[model samples]
Target: MRRAAPLALLAALGAAPLAAQDSAPCGGDFGTFLQGVEAEAVASGIDPATASAFVAGLGPDPEVIAADRRQGVFQLDFLTFSRRLISQDRIDRGRAMADRHATTFDRIEAEYGVPRGVLLAFWAFETDYGAVQGDFGTLDALATLAHDCRRPELFRPQLVAAAELFAMGEIDHATTGAWAGEIGQVQMLPADILENGRDGDGDGRIDLKGSAPDALMSGGAMLQALGWRADEPWLVEVTVPDGLDWASTGLNHPRPVANWAAAGVAARDGALPGGGPGTGLEARLLLPQGRNGPAFLAYPNFDVYFEWNQSFVYVTTAAYFATRLMGAPIYLAGDPDPGLSGEQMIALQEKLVARGHDVGGVDGILGERTREAVQVEQQRLGLPADAWPTPALLGAL
Candidate 1:
């Protein structure tokens, strides 16, 4: 799910008032909690009447809490997640949307340095090109999460920002969106909308839900604000030679393109982009499913994907799908070694935690910290440090 822009950036955008609040006790009467939220919102510059009406009759949304607790879908492996999302229908529709909004796309690229594929890929994944933004009430979801004590510090400020949006007449208590409170076609949180939203349609109002240009442009602006390099390649499919040192392969180990090229990493279709000699572009070798599976050279631009979403599977899929939308050929999915099941992953994480390795949580998801710990364990076990957990690795541990 989407979060607000990074706190540093949010502060630069004058969002300090909302972020400065200390965490209060959670899990009490919903009405009393909302009263405090409303008072806090007004203190954070929300109009009094707006804050009152925004929280009027608001209660903790049980549906939001239930949805928050049910996120096992992220446990799917990279191939499974990418295959489920990057459908032929999505590709065709994405191209159609790009062509339909050529002028807006051109303007966004010229102004924000973000291509149509990047925006369209996110638009497709987020809401199927604005087809199915979530149905949860945005205000209720934010307020509920704010008072739920699970991640109150994160969601409480978002609730205040949504109240500020309500004050601006941008959204209302009935605004429906993702269960995490991300709204509109591109699924942005309220603070992000407030900071980076644009009126691309020239109607003087940023209507991300009703207007395609508005949503696409606002997404482009957000990416630019998140540090997208102009006219840079984010991900490139590549063929890796055997006997390569697998320990140095991951998003954490970025090497110069020339160095990687000299080491025998070749682009699948064309010559490796070495940033034209001495430009010093770097890339990290990424093997999402291990050395034998689909491989990529994820460049610096690809790092911006994490700022958009934290799920490695989702970000990699979105980056690769952006390449697909830009006319890259379908990737060759090679025979990869079997990965751990969700239960096995959880067990492995528990073991890692016992051994003083922080896997970020014992959730089934193979996040970056988990991957780092896995690589270390694989190295200690004299296995290939491809960072992909397998049955053998688990048995050894």
Candidate 2:
């Protein structure tokens, strides 16, 4: 899921105006919200005890909302984020954890057909391998988000699912430990916990808090359900030939490897991996830092990484971390330009919009659509079509 924006954090804290009210009308009291929620739970067939226990102390939590807002600023750059999250210390810790819980990870990989490294990588990323599950009350966070107006439509159902968890005795109101009501070491949402979590430890309880086996196994199970191919790579860094037609490479428009080779696109070492000719997998050419930076051929499984975290940088970092875990070399190329500011990006978007070009939503985030729009404008202006955002581009705009 995308990290909660600043506005989302404010709304979750009940600092923003209610969606139902136009001009800061009287807000719904906690008592009133709980009463309505209790009624809904009972009508939804939940027992009274479960409903009361779940809703008794639920309210807006300022600290959690603050944390959510702060998360947006924590990882400003991909390299910094990767260095912190996938540090040598982290890798050593993960390897030790994997060794200690070899039986659990082995069984999980065998059953789910997910690589142990990938599962371990996710475990390390989600909660620092259980070393730092958030200390805030999970119920409070869920209740705050559910009662808040900005994304009540998205979080209210999660609130309902949390109540169901309580009703089923899967978890009590006291044991949950996620930022947004996600439970367990893997930080799984309530619905995912209900659907995919497993008792790998076989202790007659699905304990995610204290059981490494359960958490790792549950994570592998979720990935399996998402169609993780056991032997296929998620993505690979490749060399794109000069003068290659980037428009031909899109997510929906796939061509065979042979066809791509015919078009002068070849693997970096002049040898394609053993996926056979014309595997029919669609791919896209990704130039994260324009024409001078390292390139990648992303496949469908790359999209699956986005399901975990929507940010392109997040997915790319995960893929890179996976490569590191597999003993692959780090990316040797540097980003062409990393100093672009949010204001400059916004200015560029405004200029594009003024020119009657759609750059998608102008949130100052340079996504693929924004990059493509910038490239089109650059081509129209007789500039280089590298699709990179720079201060010079902003000046031209």
Candidate 3:
């Protein structure tokens, strides 16, 4: 759910030769780089023998580097990505995994105060419960990104951490794969493995390779660190008034239920949950598909879910999947803005820019800023200011 910055996308687009050029700073000599990294690892408390063995004869993986360069295309509309990621197959697999690992999951939940269903949801979403944890070398991926000029400042430290992991004998050069240099069942980065990885199975090493216990426990620890509240719902379906002030609901904004109810918002069914009208738990009303699709009142824990992955669709899908694993219903409605396609969306951005609106960039993606601009344009055109982009709106522009 990591939201790539525009700079990251730009780097991805311009990566091939630039990545090669950036590697020159390390002198096009993998052996020297390995030696230097080993020296640093020893200085940072790694054993000399372990460092030597781990950093021996490693080279840049061109395949992994090329894959990094092509990550720009992975960005998709939130709902689209969610629908594919949280499919029925994944849900059924998660439920089965939950049942298979019931004892381990129960222990993790009791210890970490995270629900088993939520843990299973992350398990299913991240690496399919340890079934398909990519096939790239972690050291190669981190080193390539670190050597690349795009975000060396960010990835270099991770490279150092990857070296340290090697020195610890936690992972070898051969058995590692992750898009952003993460590894194992939960797709944890090297730094995360170093800091938060736990020996849940008590087998001496905290191996996320095939250990469900290690993966689930480590994921629970990460979520706990991100401020996940025990036993609190991340989000609940809600119904908003037809004439509600849609502009008031933005990311991180809070509105009490009393205030929302006064404005004619209500629970999707009949009544609110156990919490009082003014329970002091501030919530944000989100209309992801403008006002025409299903609505949700997101709680603080929902933001915690976002920390795991920044995409709204990702968090919502995780929450929804968790609910499903707990016997809750699927979403009552579908995406409202079904007409918007990538090319059409990009065209809309071009038209918006032509009209003197600064939409950040002419990317096809409709982020919060783009949605706001679309809303403004809709108002100016005497159309519904629901912020839902359409082909008709594009032609009119």
| Per-model CA lDDT versus the true structure | 0.84, 0.66, 0.69
Candidate 2 ranges beyond 4 A from true positions: 2-28, 74-77, 248-275, 352-361, 382-386
Lowest summed-lDDT stretch of 10 residues in model 3? 3-12
The regions of model 3 sitting more than 4 angstroms off are 1-56, 69-79, 269-278, 349-363, 372-387, 392-397
Candidate number that wins on TM-score, 1 or 3: 1
Ranking by lDDT: 1, 3, 2
Candidate 2 lDDT tens digits, 295-353: 66666666777666565555676676766666656664655665356666767888888
Residue 367 in model 1: lDDT: 83
How far off is residue 244 in model 3, in Å? 1.5
Lowest summed lDDT across 10 adjacent residues in model 1 is found at 11-20
Q: Lowest-lDDT window of 10 residues in candidate 2?
A: 16-25
Candidate 3, residue 85: CA error in Å?
3.1
TM-score of 1: 0.92
